[model samples]
Target: MVEALKIPTTLAELEALGEEVTLRIPASFEEYLEWVDKCEFTIEYFNNEIVIMGNASYYHEKLVAEIIFCLKTIFNKVTGFSVLGSNIKIHIADLISPTDFNADVSVVQGNPKFVTLPSGKKSNSKITNPVLVAEVTSKSTIAHDFGDKLLAYKKIESLQYAIFVSQYQPFVTVYERKGIHHWELRDYTRLEDSFVLMGQQLTLAEIYKDIQFEK
Candidate 1:
């Protein structure tokens, strides 16, 4: 854990760290927003701490693009659905520690409901409603993405599906909400495998398309 005060102020300085870093500092959400806004890279808020996100690898970006394309293709003709990229921020409220996260791919089934930051600033960048969220996991972020982040996403009232896709391999884990507190889990490893979300089917081949994994 790094101290927020010791963290670098510029994107270049932070990128010099060469990996994602979590800093613990006592600061208001307003300050966090201001700090992150100054940097060019992605930054996430979790439990009052700020996580300086690492740069995406080639495979990671490829997978993200593929997933977004597949999702958009599936919901293209559907009414009231939009697929979003990683740039959008998701506000996970009602938790002991509210979080602001950026998913690799997110799907909103209705007109997006935006929210104001704790600083009382209104921005379309922040969304509180998403029906589905996807994370492209890497070696450094696999744990947090699977653990605390997944739990926080499940808390979102509008969220019904959470998908975790591996960048290094052809594997994916999907969690479907079954009840108020129950979720059904499914894993897909083969390219031929597919899953249904919100009545639309997506194949693993579509997600891993154009991505090559090392043997």
Candidate 2:
């Protein structure tokens, strides 16, 4: 493993820095399993750089739970597709992505796989394919969660839509992947309107119902 270069700006610099990026020293997969069992902090490792995610707020948790519950109930009635919460893992290998970089909620096509090994370890990461994914944004991660991370997720072939829920406003931004290489952007600011995705639609007023927070 090489010493990772500090964040570089130039494309040439970034290309040069890539060689210096500390690739994960191949460790025993079993040992990683043991570490996962004991680790406490929710972390994400991408391209060898580790990112520590901050804690979620009360409103964040509440909104996440409500969305998952609603999706579970709705999808259960329409099809066998299931809704999974942050307890699941989504990983992209050599990608130096994160660990427990939980989406507020995700919909998977089949039985849930709790431990999704990195692409380097498995033929296909368990969470590589998600019908829809949601993130409850907070002040601490408004930028990355909405910008850079969203860009990374866009690279995923199986992701259909990525959602951003803001704490400052009732508005939500939904990015739906269109065709094969494009995304359709839609904004919902009206409290009465709802955003539809994958297969189900959820009203903003209902999703944020009874919840109050700093304006």
Candidate 3:
């Protein structure tokens, strides 16, 4: 018989397991939030499972920073827009199962809305509204970034644009909400390529500035 996996009880134990490790052991949303509060690393909750997202790679971190910088520069003088980093947790509401994600970068128009955790406490770490969310994809997280996470981001009513950037290459994919249930996809592979986000033009050159890809 297959043995059941043990759930981690301490932050040290959870961190030792490393990144992208998904624990299928049954867990409640409250239990998952408790882990989120205790653990230093980022953790995701979905379908009653807790996924431990350990430290990102060097290029992963660099790419995320670059994207954030480019976005901030674009909206620096613009009002009613706030650029957020990965530290913020985005709550994906309207789904049957509880879902939360840490995007590489998030852009919110107007005031950001905070979500109440299952503990009945308000959390600044969690936000409910983001018009644009970006994710830096690596080999370890590419599946979740493009699959489950992408689908969940669409369900977020406040989300309009979802950007995915590759750490291994100068490639970026954008999903723009075209209709209530329709989305338009655009891909950029060259440094000169640019895309319109929230009516602002962003080129790949700026997003991948100072970024080197392995050949």
TM-score of each: 0.92, 0.73, 0.90
Q: Residue by residue across 1-215, what tens digits does model 3's lDDT show?
A: 11135555566876677755655545667777766766656778777767665557678888888998899988886778999998898887654678878888999999889998766889888998999999998877888889889989998888899999998888999999999899999999999999988788999999888988733
Q: What's the distance in Å from true for residue 87, model 2?
A: 2.1
Query: Per-residue lDDT for 116-199 in model 1, tens only?
Result: 766677879989999999999888789989987898998898999999998889899999999989999999999999999888
Candidate lDDT scores, in order, read: 0.84, 0.63, 0.82
Q: What number of clashing residue pairs does each candidate have, in the order they appear?
A: 0, 10, 0
lDDT string, candidate 2, 54-103, tens digits: 45667778878877776776787677586877765665433343433457
| Order by TM-score, highest first | 1, 3, 2
Clashing pairs in 1: none
Stretches > 4 Å off in candidate 3: 1-25
* TM-score top scorer: 1
Worst 10 residues of 2 by lDDT: 1-10
lDDT (0-100) at residue 43 of candidate 3?
72
TM-score winner, 1 or 2: 1
Error of 3 at 50 (Å): 0.7
